[model samples]
Target: MVKIYGHPFAAFYWKVLIALHERNVPFEFLMLDADHPQHGEAVARLSPTGQFPVLIDADHVVIESAAIIEYLDLHHGHAPPMVPADPRAAIEARQMDGIFDDYVMAPLSRMVFNALRDTDKQDPHTITVAQGTLDKSYA
Candidate 1:
């Protein structure tokens, strides 16, 4: 089975997990503490950036969430792909996905973990800037 090495609550990890889950792919979620010794080895072996959401499929290693998600969509064509097949539709979908990753994903993610830690108070300026970027997502 494919094994994903990552922290459970991490946004990038969750993104890859969600992509696999949405594709109905079978995978083992190996939760890793950032400070763990094996975590460094796990990351160094796969991730160029020493980051989480590193996927181990047998002996092959895959890093970066967008690449992981695209691989899932390509390999598991049984499920409807996130992007439309048409050239324009695929281009637009990719653009929107980028905007979501840039805007909604971060601040909205802060809302999730910060609520648990009681840290990272919401910044109105950040929200306004995010909203402006989101508006461009639809353009």
Candidate 2:
């Protein structure tokens, strides 16, 4: 069975979980929190950036949500691929993915991370910029 190392709160990680559910793929969700030291260690060892949502399948270790999703679609033999099979449709899908990541999620992630920081430690300027980006993206 495939194992995914991630925290439930992570936005990027949620995409992988959604994909797995959509395809009816069975995977173990390895929670990476204070309680799961071993899972955290495994993720730190496998992921290049020590990031969450690392997918381990047999001997293969896949990092990055997009790559992991693509790997699943290709290797898991699911009913319908998350990405379209058609050339033009695939390109458009990929483009939309890039746009969402860069314009929407990037700033949103920045804001979320900033919110997690201590009240005084958080950078107001950064939050302002992120909010501005989000506003533009939404518009």
Candidate 3:
């Protein structure tokens, strides 16, 4: 069984979770919160950057949502490949995925993270810039 390490509310985690569900792949979700028993140690052991949405399959550990999805597509056979089989189509699909992740999710993630910082340390200008980027991407 595959083990997924992440917080439920994390967007990247949801992205990988959705992919796993789409493939009907059964996995154990290891919710990592500050309060969780294995939050500090286990998560750090699995992911070097301390990021969520790490996938563990036996002795193999996969980090990053995009990489996890690709690993799943390669290792687990399911209906409708996450990335198309054709080289050109696959390249386009991956490119679009990168655009969505970078242009859309990246700004949103920065804003959310900034919001979580101490009020005195928060940068309104940064948040505004991120919002503008998001708006432009949406347009």
Encode model 1's per-residue lDDT on 29-65: one tens digit a residue.
7767656777668787677788778877777788878
Clash count list over all predictions: 0, 0, 0
Q: Tens digits of per-residue lDDT for model 2 on 1-139?
A: 9999888888889988988998889998888999979998898889879887899999999998888888999988466998888989989978977877788888988988899999988998988998888888888
TM-score versus the correct structure, for each prediction: 0.69, 0.94, 0.93
* Model 3 lDDT on a 0 to 1 scale: 0.87
RMSD of each: 4.2, 1.2, 1.3
Error of 1 at 97 (Å): 1.5
Q: Which structure among the candidates has the greatest TM-score?
A: 2
The sequence of per-residue lDDT tens digits that candidate 3 reaches over residues 49-123 is 887788889999899899999899989747687988899999998998898899888899999989999999999
What residue pairs are clashing in model 1? none
Q: Quote the positional error of residue 50 for candidate 3 in Å.
A: 1.3
Model 3 residue 18 distance off true place after TM-score fit, in angstroms: 1.0
